[model samples]
Structure formats: structure tokens, C-alpha cells
Target: MGTDISRPEHPPLARRHAWSLAAYRHMLRKRLTGQPAADLKSIADKRWDIAPGEITVSPPAIYLPGQMERVTGWEGQRFYPYVHPGPTMAGGLSIEQGPTRGYLIKNVWLIDGALYKGNASHWLTLKPQRFAPVLVENEIERGAIYCTQNGNSWFGTWLMEDCVTYALACDEGVPVTSAPSARYPLFTQAPPYEDWLGMNPLRLRTAFFHQLVLFDDVSHNRSRHQRYRAMGDKLLTHVEHAPHPGVFILRGHEGDLRLLRNELEVAEHMCVKWGFRVINPLRLDVPTIIAACAGARVVMGVEGSQLVHGVNVLQPGGTVFTLQPPNRFISYYKYMTDRDGQHFAFVVGTPDGDGFTIDINEVERTMDLLPKH
Candidate 1:
């Protein structure tokens, strides 16, 4: 792995008090490309027949008729009972991208409101320029909401990318709004041997946290837990023992077991440093893992899906730090935090330096600027 400076710190201000137009210009560039933004005025202004009592709704492309029947048992059902369809596992029942299209409203419906967990109107729309269009008639019959539960394995990139793309598209629309819920399922469930490489479609859903703190590479290296706990002891407040906190450690199919060994070592070390307990759930469920992160003040790990989990769990203005390969994929942190309206930073470890050394000064500096929740 090689390292290059992708996004570097801005030059120091000679006069901190004086306003710099250059700084504003730099900030503008970062905002436009980094965070979710779309050009969708046509869809935002259109008035759809939002029928009275319609509680849930979504596009038809991402949902499959078979899956709907299985979940809702509404065989040959015509009318939708809710405004927003609840989470579904069907791959096709989702909103599509086009020149700001029309809206579709169906009959009102009811759902287990408890399942509708997370911030309201928190979603990110994406445009899959490469994949074939999945929508049909731009309308879908609303039914029970189905959330996708598979993202960590073969379909991980596809689903995550789709979610990210959706968020960006929505941002482009006039009077932009965030999606209400983002669904992250396990990757192991993905159909075997699905190609992960290629221009996969991106998607975005509403996030649980106002800000996402991503920690990567928890298990890939050595003594990770000790290093993280030492770091957390300095940054977090009210560290508590979670007997069974659902924590998800993302791993690739190849070389993943080795990575897990490394991450486990780190977790063990962290426990020793801060007396912080490690809670490993037998099953890696996304919702449960997210709930645990939601309760956390600081999230630290190697750069991986756990970081993505942190993204979903962090409160607005929360801070995240992940390990960076000496050179490759350095800008990922910036790409995530800047575009998503969250505080992002990275720590690069030298081969000869301490196994873990975070730029505490930088962490403090970033934390100071975070919005008070």
C-alpha cells in the first residue's frame, strides 16, 4: 500500500480574524462535490395526488411483487394501506432516478410504528447510470415496509452505493430533504459469488445519527482493542460496560479471517487499557449494532464497515477516527464526512511508529467545531 496526500489541511491563516474569500471558495468546492447534492427541481415542484390517509409510499422499481406478497400477504392486493411502505427485502422496490419525475400517492395504511425507527425524513437517493432501470411506471403499490438486510458481503457495495446515490439525488432536488430511514443489512446473506467490482448503483437512506462517526479496520491489525480504548478514554465520556452491545466488524470474503484475528486482539487490548468491556453479539444484525452505536459517544476502528456503522450511529457533531493505509484510499474519510455533513478525520500509522497513534490535537480541534447536540 502506498500513501499520497489526497486532501490536506488548509494553509494556516496569517490573520485569523480577517475573513478570507479564498477559504470560502475552498469550502464551497468541498461542499458541492463532497456532500449529497442533486439537480432535481422538476420532481420537487410536482404535485402528486397524495391521497388522504396514505401514510407511506415509495417507487415501484426496487420492490418485487413476490417479496411484497410474502411480507404483507397481500396476494393480488390492489390498494396500499400506508403512506410509506415499510422496510422490505425485495431488491427492486425503490425510487428511481430521472429528470425530476412525478410523485405517486396511494391509499392510507398502518404499520408497526416501532419498526419505523430513526429520524423522520432521513434518506439519501442515488442515480445508477450504469445499471438497467429498475422502476416500472414510476409507481409502486404501497404495502408493509421492507428493509434490505444484506450489505456486508457480495451486494454490500451495490446496496451501499445505491443508498449513497439516492441521498445525493435527493440533495439535488429543490427544497432538498433527507430520507427518513437507511437500511443496512448483513453482507453474508448476499447470494454467493456476486461480482462486487464494477460501476455499482449507489443508494442512501435516512441515517440514525445526525452525524456519522466512521471507525475502520478494527480487527485486521494487532492489539486494536487496547489502542482504541486508550484513544476512547481520552475522547469519550461515560464509558460503560455493554454485556451484549451489538457491534458489527465488516470483513471481506478473502483474507477476512486474518483481519478478524487482528481486530479481536485490538479489542482485547482496549479492554485492558480502559477497563471497557467488549460485547460481541452472536449474530451480526445491523439494527441491533446501530442501536449500540447510537448509545456511544466515540467510535474508533480500522477503516471498514464498522466505520459505516459509526456513520449510522453517531450523533450530529460527533467525531470519528479510522486507520489509514500508508497510502491508498486516503480520501475515503474526506469523501464520507465532508459530503455527508459530519466531522471526519484520519490517522495514518507509520510502520515503525506506535501501533496506534491518533493526532489528538487534530481530534480535539475537530471536536471543538462540532455542533452541540
Candidate 2:
């Protein structure tokens, strides 16, 4: 597990500035008359006895441009979810991807207006942010809100992916947050059919933060896969469209954090050589994105949440290539592909100026490795 978050090189200047602004936001949020829990497990309103407390999973295979043998996941050790709330879990859920720009993490569970417990994870090195709940400006009186980190990033890609699977405990949750008493529009106006990979559709009833948030996370227990492929089936059924046999997803609006320095060069290679249909996710709305990806057999991109578009649309015989940044190597997409029926490959690249560059040779090598269709 050479997997570590610390970078040998500094992030681009834009990221540093954004992170500084987030520091101020964290300072303000910390002043909120709220509380945080020291540990998440202590406040569980309910727990799943059937769910395994611990399980081992084979790590996703990661490739580098030069190596014949592939390396493995982030933080190479097999990670287990410290706890599991079980399926269709409905409770308070809040997540802060980082101390910057978005939300702040709060650990204390609120019983009444001011009553609280637990501790929020540290922003940097001390405690990790993954298990902590996000602190919002207000709380939802009713309904379950959706808050997910989309980068498949260091930004803490939390459990909404889990909501796609474990949330399958229920296909339809009443959208009551819109009622007079309930006040959050929530993430899903309808089931975010575009985001589903398989499992019953996640019917979100709330947003912001909820007094009771309904969400789930199995990234810790990633071996349990099947529901994801099921959700993909549902998405495909709804899409009823087709696309290029090969696809390449770009990290459109995600900014230049791990920008591929020679992305255009690589994109041309993928397009001309592999005949991959290129997709810039930010440019298209969800429906359009789904239409472009509905029947795509291969999805490739810089390792990030945008890949989910093509990853969800893939069938039994498909391939997903992740151009992983050396500093951030997450197998999140691999978990979705594995056991669910798709070939997943990654090429770790050499660092370029602000971003990194992928080798055309590595691209060709990986293309050769893809299970021939």
C-alpha cells in the first residue's frame, strides 16, 4: 500500500487558493453553536446485525506505464467499514469533502436544537474526514438529503455510491421534504436515474442536511457487488439509446486539480486509434450525458467520479481505463466494475508541470490489455 495522500509536489496554485478560502469557511462553521461526535459508532440510532462487521476483499489491480506487474489500491491495506448502518438506512447524514469551499464536518449527533455528541474529523492529517457528518447552515426538519463527493477524489468521495446499492433496501422513498413541514428540495427531484449503476433507484426526499438522512456506504465492504449492475440495467432500460462502442470521459468542470497535461494529445489517440467517443461530462446535462453513454461498451478517463457515466452504461463485456494521478489512487470505480462484469485498468503517469502526462506507449499497452471485444 504505497497509497498515501501526501503529495511529493504541491497542488496547482488555484487549488491552494481554494483550500485557503475553505480554511476561513471551516473557521466560521466551527463557531456554529453545533456539536460533533468523537466516534460515529457510539451514536448509531440503529445497526444491522446481519451485516458483517469486517470482511476482506481482493484489491483492484492498478497499472503503471512501465511495469508488467500491476500495483493495487490507495492505502494498500484492506479497509473495513468501522460500522454498518444496514440497508435502506435512514438517519442523519452529513459529509464535508474538505475544509475548503463546501461544507464543514460535524460529529456530534443533535438530539434537540443544541444537544450534541461526537467529534468531527480533523481537516488535515489528524483525524480523517470520511466518517464525519457535514455541518450545514441549517438542518432538515424532515426527509433524507444527498451529499456525495464526486471526484472519486481526495475530496472524500463518500457513500452516495453506497446509497445506490445498500439503499436498495427501498426502491421508492416518499419525497416528503417538499411538504410544508419538510423543507429540503434534496438532490433528486426524481430518482437520479442518471447516477444509478444497479440496485433499486435511490429516491431522495431531502437535501442540505436532514434531521433524518437516508443514505448508505459500502465502499468499506466493496466486495458485495451486484446491485450496482442491476441499477445499470435500470438506467439502460430508461435510456433505450446507444452510443459509440468506445468512450473517453473528460473531467470537464472539475477544474485543473489533476489535469492531464497532454489530455488533447491523449484524447486524439483514444479517438483516432480506439474510436472512442469523447465526453466532457460538465458540458452535458444528466439526460444528455446518459444518452451519450447509454450503450457505450468502454469508458476511460482520469480517475474521477465523471467516469460513472460510462461505467454505469457498460454491459457484460466492457472496459474502463482510469488515468490515475499518482498522489490520488482510488479504486472506487473498480469496485463498481469488478464482480459486476467489466475489465478495469489504470495507468499511473509521470508528473508533469501542474498536472501529469500519460504515455502514448502506456495507452497502447493498456489498450492491448483490454479484454478483446
Candidate 3:
């Protein structure tokens, strides 16, 4: 259930120097309990020297998916277009702006995010991984809108796109993030930090100021990245559209059952030959799985992370189908369903060991190439 994510993406340098010496001995044991650390020669700061191209962050971190998007799952299985995120899986520290004062380590070093210094970029979550451990105090707090919750907090629209859309774009004030500090805008899962480290006092908290975005860079930019299309038009005004609902997203028995096996015979063969409606966005509750994938035209799933609530509500021209498993072929939700124009398919499946097996006659010849409106 670990390692071998297709292996060799190059994680060696004595295992990245033992994960940066266990995150620099956990900040030298948080400076022997007093917890101060951050000197790194007092951050010379060339506006925090970032390099290795295409940099222009800010705004829910900035989405990133380009290259004539349209990626299928089978064939020789290879599609490459979006580039420049390779300085070591798009190398480190790139908060282009943040709770800037510094030091927010996790999974240890190259000095993780909110770094008022350098490392260069790639926290923008959703399967890209790593980037949630704050402490950036370039002193902003005036209007007070800090937010932290990088990614994979086990979904609920990823805490409604990393930390409940910046306190749902807070205004009444004090909607902070970074550590289990100022919460309340709640989204459950992955922020217990051991019950907020036993009822408060450290998940790192410090954010001088922040409002970043990285719902995998707004699911790879485009769809008018208006903070995830105004967070998918405010979750479709509390959802209630459903018509040609062919939901089908079931990775049931949750967490790592990605070992699909016969996922209940592929959810009873998509409700007896594609009438479909097998939900299970981890047993509902994200507003009842956003009203069962609201107004769906066809949502289908299997790529994982619960098809991010069918890329924030299917509808619009519909079709976000995905069933990949050629050992994890992944298509970052085809950069937000090809910038919300929709219709992004996939069918691979056939590895079976660490899980894989879907072909239902290529899922009915890919639902007979859908789009028949």
C-alpha cells in the first residue's frame, strides 16, 4: 500500500538526504522546545529567489494545465504537454506570496511552503502531494484572511478547495488558517492534528497573511479559474439539479481500497448497463456529496479523490468519465474537465495486484462515445 508510484521519479540523493535530515531534525527539535528557528542566514530574500520557469503565482495558488488538453486512458498511454514543473517533480518552496515570515516544515525540508525564502513551487495539491505546514509572518493580518489546508484532507471538496474557500472568502473577520489555530469554518478530516495536538497549541500556526490557491492549481487552470468558478458557483446554490444523473463514483470501503478488485462488480455493472447512480463520495456528507453530484449529465469515476465531486458539479455539457488503472495512469481531472468545457474520457484498467481491472467492454465502448444530448 506504499511506494512504487511507478517508481523512479527520482527520489534519491540518499533518499533526498533522508528527507532533509528528518526535516532538519524537526527544526532542531523546534529549537529545543523554545521553538523559534528560521535564521537561514536571515533569509537574504531576493523577493525570495525562485527559478525553473513559468512562475506567476497568487490567487488560490494559480492553476496549471496546458497543452491542448484531451487525454484518454488506453492506447500506449502517454500524454505530455504541461511542462516546467520539473526541477525535481517541480522542485520546492514556491508560495509566491504568503504568511511570509517563514518556517513551516512537514515531510521535511527544501524548506516547505510559506517560506519567505526559496525552494521554487509545487504544493498545489491533488495527487501532486506535499505542502501543508505553515508559519509565514510577513505581517499582513490587517483585514485578517489567512487560510491553510494545502491538500488531501481526505476530501469534502478538499475542505471546499483547501480550507473552505478562504473562510468562504471571509469578511466578518478572523478566519485564520495554519495550524489548528483559528478554525470554525470547519470541513472535517485531516485537521485533527491529534485533536489539535490535544486541545490546541501548535500545528505550526503563524500566517502573517495568506490567501493562496492550489486546488491542484485550480485543477490545472482554465474554467475561468475564478476561485474555482466562484467555487463552482457556490456549490451550485446548494445543489438540486439532477436529471440525466449517471453518477457512478464508487471507491467504496474507502481509504486505499483503490485495490479495486471487483468493486462490487464495478458497482453492479454501472447499475445494470449504464443506467448508473452508484455514488459513495466516501459515504456522503459534503452536502450529501453535493447533492449526489448535482445536476450531473454523467460523472463516472475511478481515478480517485472521489472525482472531486465530479469536478465541482458535472452539468455543463457533462462527461468526466475516468476508470484508469494502468497502474495509475491519472489525468489530473483533465485539467478541470478541459477548462470546464467538459467531456474527458478514460478506460485503461488491467493491472490487478495493487488493484486494477475495468474494461466492461471498454465500459461499453466508452459509453458509446457519450455526448448525444
**Candidate of highest TM-score:** 2
Residues 1-373 of candidate 3 have per-residue lDDT tens digits of 1111111121221211112233334444656876554533333222221112233232111112221122222222222223322221222423321111212222212223232222222222112113333322222222122233334334533433444344322422233333332222234534431131121111222232222211112223332244556656666676576576577878754654556677678768877876777777645656666676777677777766777766676656777777766544554555455545666666656666667677576677667767687
Best by lDDT: 2
For candidate 2, write residues 1-373 as lDDT tens digits. 0111122121221211101123233434566845542333344454333233333233334354343222222432322222221110121333111110112123222211112333332211222232222332223223222333231222223232533433432321211112111222223312454344332222311122223333334343322344555666667776667656678888843744768888878877889997877878666666777778777777788877677677766777677788877655555555455446666777776667667778888888777767666
- Estimate every model's Cα lDDT from 0 to 1: 0.29, 0.46, 0.44
Estimate, for each residue in 81-123, the C-alpha lDDT of model 1 and write its tens digit: 1122223221133322112122321221111111111111111
Rank order (by lDDT, best first): 2, 3, 1
Candidate 1 global TM-score: 0.33
Instruction: Flag regions of model 3 displaced more than 4 Å.
Output: 1-138, 143-165, 172-242, 250-257, 261-268, 271-274, 277-293, 296-304, 311-352, 356-373
- How many Å off is the CA of 96 in candidate 2? 27
Better of 1 and 2 by TM-score: 2
Candidate 2 — number of clashing residue pairs? 26
| TM-score (C-alpha) between model 3 and the true structure | 0.30
